[model samples]
Target: MAPASLLDLVAALPPSDGWGPSVATETTLDGVPYAPYSKADKLGRMADWTEGKDRERGGRQQYGNRNYRDQQVYGANQQNNPFGIIAAEEEATFSVVDNTRTTTRGRGFGRGGGTVFRGRGQRGAQNQRGGARGTFQRVGAGRGGQQQGYDNRGGRGGRGGRRFGYRDDKPQRNRDASIQVRPDWALLEEIEFTRLTKLSLDTPDGEDIDSYGFLYYYDRSYDKQPGAKTSEKRLNVLERAAYNVTTSSDPIIQDLADKDEGTIFATDTILSMLMCSPRSVYSWDLVLTKQGDRIFIDRREGSSLDMVTVNENAADAPLETSEGNKDTINSPSGLMMEATHINHLFPIQVVQESESAKRDMPNEHPFYNPAEETDPAASKAYRYRRFDLSLADSEEALHLIVRTELDAVVKNTISGEDQFLTIKALNEFDNKAQGSGGALDWRTKLASQRGAVVATEMKNNSFKLARWTTQAILAKADMMKLGFVSRVNPRSPNDHTILGVLGYKPREFAAQMNLNLANGWGIVRTIVDMVLKMDDGKFVLIKDPNKNMLRLYSVPNDTFEDEGSVMEKVEEDGDDE
Candidate 1:
């Protein structure tokens, strides 16, 4: 006979509807029959049976009858005619015969030499035995072994074997990591302002006027270099040169002074004058006054003026009067001029053009215009006029000089609360050109003093750090090799990689390892989707993220060789690897 197929047997067996042949007795091609209860079909049948039993026990039922008496009679009769009555009767018949069977001689058998008795009792017994044997054999034999095993082992044995030991199918540990780097510097400055005033005079002997001055404050340390010395030296040299030239009585200076004294002197003197000078002052005085009346006084020099006071009725007097008018009409001799307000002032320093002087030297000439049939004197005069006009225009170019004094108490790192240098300037202007004049015009002299103020505010620190980390990662050779990965879909540009480096020292290794347990290089990228690392005993690129289009990963101790080998191995493994 052909070997039996397990699948074919299962298909041919009864379905899980309590009908057809049992799923047991299926056999492999070698003729080993499978246990029916252990088959998938029997499990399904058991499941259905369990569900049905649960439903019957839990569900509500209705009895259909003509009246209350009929329903009562139907329920009463159900006890005698319970469900499964036919199955129970069949089981009882098989059980009776099975119980009475002789252990060694209960089948169709041939007559032995020891005994051969034929009679009505024997014949009837034999026929009865044959009928019993046929009925019990097939069903009882199939269940015997399985029922015994279930009873002994508690129904757990004979099922598929349980799995044990290690598995290689677990997911591989991740290896990507990430970090951040911030901007190099902060780049802005602040400005401070004050009021200013100026005075001029004319006289018979000369223009001698007593000038009053006021001052303002400014700070310049923001733009000044930290350790600059060239500017200081230049300033000292200029001051000394000005003093020597002005004080000298040399013949050359005298001759030049004689030719066009006013013009030359005006240029030199004005140029030599300090950029900042005080121009105004403030004062106040008080006098006795009657109720509902006005009073006036004036004090003038070189005049025999007597003290006088004017008193007017409050209702008839004008609301206010001028100081000059009040002084001339009332107490002219004992004039009390009260100074109420004063303005701050600053100096304007002129920055001369050194390049112009260098260009004016004879040998430095790059171009020449030869005289062709023109009068030499006329040509020379014309050239001279042109040069003068150019120089005049150039001199008019706006040059602003600012001077300020700084005073402040600062805390020194070594000696706390010590006096530190403060740099201040008069009027600070943006170093750009404007119309005829520069943006700010300051006074010559001011008494105001200012201290340097440094203001700093952080702007987008995380973003700047991310940008720097990205640049650093991209500069790395390993990172550059993955340039193709940086190309992302235009629709989702932000979905990109970022790389960074971190560091750890011997002392920090344990903590770093613990941190790695929750967030290591590879898994970090899985969470934040970026690469990063620790290196040289420090957390280098801790702030980098995917938006930067770069990422970092740690290599073995021999970084250079190991990194190259790792990349080779990854490429060999698969495309994504």
Candidate 2:
């Protein structure tokens, strides 16, 4: 048999299935059944040296060996093969220590649903690269409270996103009230700006009751190419008589009240402030007096309401001396005074001021007295206007009379008609200084980026600009002139230079600002309704110093009497000096 060839022995063997025992009929072979197997199972080496090589390179799907990728345990299916050995029950408690380092990401509540684990792993690869333009990305803090990048351009590229951290370093703004509140002021009602914004009352265009004073023709030379070296002019201080008479102090308003011309009487200065109260940031107070059926809106002498504020609506407005502001000239009060002085002189300087070029109104100057006054009269015209504010549900007519003013007059080139103009000046302090509200360099950008410059002013000085526009519309001025005035030197506050002047239609400018006259009228109507229902007495409406709220108080009749008299005495003393 040993001599038989290997081929002869293979021929003598049975077929492939027949070579195995006929024991297929029996479930088990020698008391052990065959184990079920898969062809895709890895059957490589018993131990591998390159088991954790992938994990060292930051691979995510970690396996014991690359060749045995699908192998979990070495032939551990022991219910079948007789050669298989079962581990003792104590082996189940055996454990191995792994010293691998891992990063655990923290989650937070955001627009995303769950814990977003962004890291140096494969998931964070996209974020490490800068994202698309203008898209915001928020980065989470890493180990040891270290902040990561947060912005649309990512931390590595263009300007980083607005950081919400370090907010405690921001300067606190705690402004004081314009007028001190006394203990005797009894609380009446409190209203919020949100409610005022929702109010709506459609009122008709005002009718001119009477006209007074005179206006000079605009110089037109000031309209020369803005921002040009030739156009720049030194702003000179001019001594002129100007008045801001309150409603109760104006004899004309008193006469109208006597004749039952209107139930509400106010000057455009005070009326516009009330109408645009929602846009104001600084605190102010207006005195409202009810005599019989008439309501008079008046301001106390030397009130801040008469001053034009600078950047009052800015995100980081000018600070006061009390708010840790080191610069005295950039302080809120200081800026306001500078702005008020500029407005007073800027309008007068832009006009010809010649008798031949002057235009007289329908009547003579009501408050001017050449014989008793030494200073020249300012170029001004007063127009008394009336508007109907009565609602359909009201029983009687509700009318309001306001005294509006015009600064100068311009002749239309095509129509050859006299066009009324209202002049306002926007002053620039040090742009590099604190509390500039990110304003542009007016001296350089006024002509090239005029729109952007004006837009910035509109944003920073919303309250001031809104009041001016309201007054212009109230006067029905044909055009509004805005002058750009900058300090002669950034460090100096006394002297200023005119950069340029721009003109716009009153209604068009208001439209550009999205100011609604109907809404303003609605606020007036609401306040009037509240006052008309109350008893005949003096009331005070105060804007909260640090809040968007207006509070009404029932004050004594003589609340500001002593201060008024003292102010008068000071004026008289100054006049004598």
Cα lDDT of candidate 1 equals: 0.20
10 residues in a row with least lDDT, candidate 2? 150-159
| TM per candidate | 0.12, 0.74
lDDT of 2 at 549: 99
Model 1, residue 132: distance off in Å is 99
Off by over 4 Å in 2: 1-123, 127-163, 166-172, 564-577
Report the lDDT tens digits of candidate 1 across residue range 1-577: 9987667777776567576655655455565443222121111121222223323333211222122222232223332433222456654344211234433222122222122222111111222222211211111223223211111111211224222222334333221221112242111111111211121111111121111111112122222322123212111111200111121222332343344221111111111111111100111111111111111111112111111111111111111123223323122112111000000000111122232221121221111223432321100000000001012224632111111111122233475533222211211111121110221111111111111110000011111122222222211101100000110222221222111111112113223212111111122112111111112211111111112121222222232225467878889899765
Residue-level lDDT of model 2, residues 226-307, one tens digit each, is 8888999999999999988788888888889999999999999999999999999999999999988889999987788888
Q: Note the clash tally of each candidate.
A: 51, 0
Compute the lDDT of residue 277 as modeled in candidate 1. Answer: 10
Query: What is the lDDT, from 0 to 100, of the residue 485 in candidate 2?
Result: 95
